[model samples]
Target chain A: MASIVRKPKDLIAGVLFLAVGIGALVLLREYDMGRASRMGPGYVPAVISGMLLFFAAILIFRSFRGPQEVLAAIPLQAPLAVIAGVLLFALLLRPAGLVVAIIPMVLLGMFSISRTGLLSAMLTAAILSAGSVLIFVYTLGQPIPVLGYWFKG
Target chain B: MIELLGNLQIGFATAVSLNSLFYCFVGCLLGTLIGVLPGLGPAATIAMLLPITFGLDPASSVIMLAGIFYGAQYGGSTTAILVNIPGEASSVVTAIDGYQMARQGQAGLALSTAAIGSFFAGTVATLIIALMAPVLAAAALTFNAPEYFALMVLGLVVSVVLAHGSLIKALAMICLGMLLGLIGTDVTSGTERLTFGSNELADGLDIVAVAIGLYGVGEVIANLNAPAEQRTAAGKAITGLLPSRADMRRIWAPILRGTGIGSLLGVLPGAGALLSSFVAYAVEKKISRHPHRFGHGAIEGVASPEAANNAGSQTSFIPMLTLGLPSNVIMALMIGALTIQGIQPGPEMITNQPQLFWGLIVSMWVGNLILIILNLPLIGLWVKLLTIPYRYLFPAILVFCCIGAFTLGNSVFDVYVMIAFGVLGYLLKYLDCEPAPFILGFVLAPMIEEYLRRSMLLARGDPTIFISRPLSAVLLTLAALAILAVALPAVRKTRDEALVEE
Candidate 1:
């Protein structure tokens, strides 16, 4: 293993937990932690954050000694694209509406796959947009708008 | 016995109505559809389906939702047996022996064994619920804040016992869940605790977004990260759909044992089908004449867990329906659906809304029967579904989840929450951390805080009230024992070896 990165699994989990614990401690720093009899919003959280640090410490300690399971770095392309695609849809849904918003989302998702032909990707995008309109807009009567403000009344 | 039959008769009358039946059919079909899909779990499905329940009457909505829960259990085993992947958490055990059975060309027998075993278990569990709920509900009536607090404490400890791997990590995860649950405005103080001034934070995190992001989106990411060679093809092609005569005889005992274990544990508020299936698998392996056959296509492996999980799914409802405390995320969604209809789902359900209660109970049996028909004959359709590439499949699920989150409050902020958790879920998977305990922790955290406050108020700030009461004392003792037992090195080592990851 490289000197810079040791046990990734335990290391990552420990770091994650530590950050959460410390962050929570800071966030609840000012809230009134009432007595045990009548606890405030911060009481249970403070106690939990303390325990989080305890467990996170053990995990970080174990990283130096325990055997490794996953040493390889995680692949990032799929998740980033997928999450970004969904975010884009959410961003565009109200302003551009389902019909226009869905196109970019489907196109971005298909682009991540990288094997499908460009024409079919567009074809699939068109099909998905129509299906979304049919199911969510026409049949289910879900409150989503079909067209953007430019097209609608 | 006569009273049980009489109540069932009323249930039958209410459930057999056209509206209830239609919704039951929809729930079962939708459950199976999502179950066969690799990334979506029943909890996510139910959470995503929450908006649909807004318009329906309480009885029909619940009946359908209950059908979806068990129906998903049945569908999950199908994927486990065919492909090596488990479709849900409880089906993780089923994959070990089930995939082996399929590889050995007994895929048909494995699927049929699962179908028959699940049907048998579901029918019996439904009967158990009918017999036990009223009396159990009556007992629950006497429970107070101290008793409830103790019970939740026991529930959390039991959750630790059920989790695989390190007990410390499980405890930590539960604690983290409670911390997250504490976000949003404090109901008592009228002050926002973790909401950093955002109006969206006022009501706390949207649960459906969190659940789907963790289970649905996290699963897709994990599948993507899996080595290509390990993704293994679904076992050849399904052949005959019936087990050998001797096979049936051998399975009956394991099925019965599984049902007993499931029904017993499922009634516990925090434990559910996931716990039952694991215990059943371990017990079957322990008692088997050939324990080595476990990962090598043992029919008993498939039979026991399939039965146990379906039974666990049914009995898990007992605590939820009776106490209004959800045993799992799915039931939590059921509570969400009911609360949307202006009904607080607790002990009063049986006494005040008998139609909704009884109809839901009866609809479960009908749902099982419908599942049997769907699995046995429609096996080919599911096989067709199995061939769809993950590339095409995952994006659709992602899009649906986005829509589902948005529909909850028609807000973009909830969509952001789902994405954030989706990334968090992947990080946990990288650490070999299991999401099951985290989920249980998340669901129970809000209630734990509420109960602790009330109990303390009643006791006039004396913490001893928890131990001074008889029932609470007993429950707390069990929780303590659970912790102490796991702290033992020998027990911890054995548990790490026993658990199977999905």
Candidate 2:
């Protein structure tokens, strides 16, 4: 079971890296440059991509040759929540402004951890958002946008 | 000698100013605070502060930033000793003996020894910079693009020694990082290579985003998944913060050796504080009378690595200030700050901007003094911070990471990029891959590419340029020899043994 889990990830990552390297090589061919003597625009990319291919091949070969060591599996929920929270924050940052965006983001993060309750998370988020607004916007006078209603005249 | 004294006097005069002193204090204080907090290191702090330094004079800005660099080194050891979690990669070695000391009820002694050793090393390193800056700068003048490329190659090769896992995996991660570094618009051609038509990616992935995502957020994710029992506090008791007479004696030789090793290795591009600590620990173990004490509560183990880390943090500036070449990501940000201030850092900097150069040197000493003063009194306060529940702490870290990433470009895209890298970082961790070499590869790739191109151009596309130029030839030969040495069967066998032990 351990060997089965480890093999798939290694194989996938190896294939992905090789694909990216090949893609880079393909893109390099599109760049127009004069005939190469010692160096051209694509020379370094070609060399780097070639090396990547070589390494990826080695990784794949090694995976097949041995039973890879397996570690404990990562829990899925918290990471997923964190990613979702970050994406939500990014989406709402401009339209909702700093305070509104940050409050939800903080709450989502706190929820993901499972130690902090709803009331504590909300209270913590509000306090932190206020503090950040004061420090960044009021004290330092950075150009960050505040909530429209709270904007200074 | 008189000239040196005069320079020192000028440096003191500049550093003693109210504004410079204030910034230095602020930098050191903030650095220690961040360092005590797990997952935040000098690189993130410096990068976040880069834009703020734009309005200040170059000398004052540099002084504050330099303080943060060494201050973090000192602060990182505190956490490593107390909590068994290293705040930075350099502190990993400190964790070996430091955590053992904590477990054995000698946390206070370990912390004090580390702090004192760091202070001593900091003082001596500052003197080395003051005395040796001119000579080093003069020597660095001979380096051209080919030599620079060769130097970077050597640095990349040296970083492979950092990985305790499969060399193949380490090398693969490095190549992966180099490829990721190429995802933005090409500077020379003005054409987007890997942007995938996203306009936000035209400027490339922010280093802040990648670093924070990989180290900070990924660490949080990993920690949250750990079993509840393991997450429970150790609740170790504390005592006086002084080492015994024998403890001091055991550490003295290691501290001196670390200082010597650190000061020399610190000048090399890409091998900065972190590598110095690793090398220092290895050397100390090799030379120790009781090598078995290393992974236990050995004072020398903590003292040597911490001192070396701090010393290396200070001297890394030598390359950036003297040769206009940044040794790491933080120094790269500093270059941008200097350029915005209309100051070019090179051999001519000393002659053209004496006040700035000397002022920075002077400020470093003040910064070290300030860090020691601020840190010793604040150790108790920092210790209290560790008692805060991880649930509350992790959210705050996430907020800071997000804000820091967003502030880098005022674009939401950087935040997304950070999250992506966070996932990649977690994946890498699970796969037993070291992220440091990848960072080295990413940071050095562009410079390497530019140098290779220029070398060829200078030689009129001649294939023999690498071998024809005597300096380039020598550097290339060294790189080749290093690769060959590592690849040799005898060396490989030893390296494999070392990897198993590590």
- In candidate 1, stretches whose alpha carbon ends up further than 4 angstroms from where it belongs are A1-8, A65-70, B228-237, B243-247, B268-271, B285-296
**Per-prediction DockQ scores?**
0.64, 0.52
Docking class of 2: medium
Clashes of each: 0, 0
Q: Report candidate 1's fraction of native contacts.
A: 0.62
**Model 2 lDDT on a 0 to 1 scale:** 0.75
lDDT per residue (tens digit) for residues B224-335 in model 2 = 7765423122455567777778877878888898888788877765546777888898888898889998898888888888889878877877877777666766666566
| Top lDDT model | 1
Q: What is the Å distance of residue A90 in model 2 from its true position? A: 1.6
List where candidate 2 sits over 4 angstroms from the true fold. A1-9, A37-43, A148-153, B48-55, B103-105, B227-239, B242-250, B268-272, B282-296, B329-348, B493-502
| Per-residue lDDT of model 1, residues B382-479, tens digit only | 87887877766766676677777777777879888888888988878777787767777777777888889999989889999988899999999999
What DockQ does candidate 2 have relative to the true complex?
0.52
TM-score of 1: 0.93
Report the lDDT of model 1 for residue B191: 83
Kindly report, for each predicted structure in the order presented, the TM-score of its chain A compared with the true chain A.
Answer: 0.91, 0.80
> What lDDT would each prediction earn against the true structure?
0.81, 0.75
